[model samples]
Target: MIKLKRNDKIGLVFFLAFIISMSLVWLFEERFDQEQWRSNPGKRYKMAKNIIEQDLLDNKSKEEVIQILGEPVTAEFSDNNILIYQLGTPPSFFDEEPQELIIVLKDSKVIHVSVNQEE
Candidate 1:
């Protein structure tokens, strides 16, 4: 076997560490993003409103949402046929527009969820 220079050995260790650390982060990153997404109710509302107003329902499946909401309003086809379901209508205050909860779905499952806020 050929001998590696000291710096080369260090670089190899760093590269391996980076690969391993990033792999772990990638595995747990979803939980981190979802943690706050669930605690904040206002965010969930806005997300739902966006799904309906902006026509992002295509990102999720209708049947999946039906299981959650028990029905749907109207929606077009999703690019990958994933199911997106907004949980609740926005809570309005001071006669302002109501914020809604946004639910993101993938492969007929709820993957990401959040809410929208009005300023």
Candidate 2:
């Protein structure tokens, strides 16, 4: 049997630890849930990735978007057709800026959706 050197063994342990930590993080990640999204504002960031990637709001009417995501934080302005939904601050070791779900509307229909830091 081939024996590993002390440094090699230490490196292997560190690598295994890293892999295990990443696996745990992935397994515990939150998925998109309509009820959860509506009820849990602080956890919205956990599911925002899924909503954006799936294009759930693509081409949806403003009213339909309200029904799905509830009333936006900002009122509809005549100058700009955009909606902002607060996603709250993500859980982190360091203080991070709160996030927002920005939905751009054109002709009363959703055209773009993105998550960005609060300004």
Candidate 3:
């Protein structure tokens, strides 16, 4: 039979709490990862681009972009109000670069779309 000392019991409680909190964090993180904003080379982003082109959503209002693409991963820049869609490719897992779909906006309208590959 094993009995925990007072300090040992306190330490064990803290340890258990820590482990449970961490597990909860891990679970929620997995849920958050599945959110649309997490930059992936999946068909969703492709469909987003296609929406911009086919629906002529490009050159439209910011609301239009949001309606099509959902919330951006980052802010629209202050200077040019550049809306950046950061994308990652599974095939480029070894590559440390992230592909960017940069939507340059002026007067709350998309003016240019640049596809940049970060190196």
Top candidate, metric TM-score: 2
lDDT of 3 by residue, 2-118 (tens): 998999999999999999999997665422123454444453333334434554456788878766666666665566487766555424557645566677778989887655674
Lowest lDDT 10-residue stretch of candidate 2 = 71-80
Q: For each candidate, give its TM-score against the true structure.
A: 0.34, 0.72, 0.49
Error of 1 at 30 (Å): 3.7
| Model 1 regions more than 4 Å off | 31-63, 68-119
**Off by more than 4 A, model 3:** 1-55, 90-96
Worst 10 residues of 3 by lDDT: 29-38
lDDT of 2 by residue, 9-92 (tens): 999999999999999988987778889989998889998898888899999998999899998889557755999999999977
In candidate 2, stretches whose alpha carbon ends up further than 4 angstroms from where it belongs are: 1-27, 93-95
Highest-lDDT candidate: 2
Better of 2 and 3 by TM-score: 2
Query: Model 2: what TM-score?
Result: 0.72
What lDDT score is found at residue 61 in candidate 2?
Answer: 93
Instruction: Identify the superior model by TM-score, candidate 1 or candidate 2.
Output: 2
| RMSD to truth, every model | 10.5, 3.8, 14.1
Candidate 3 Cα lDDT to native: 0.61
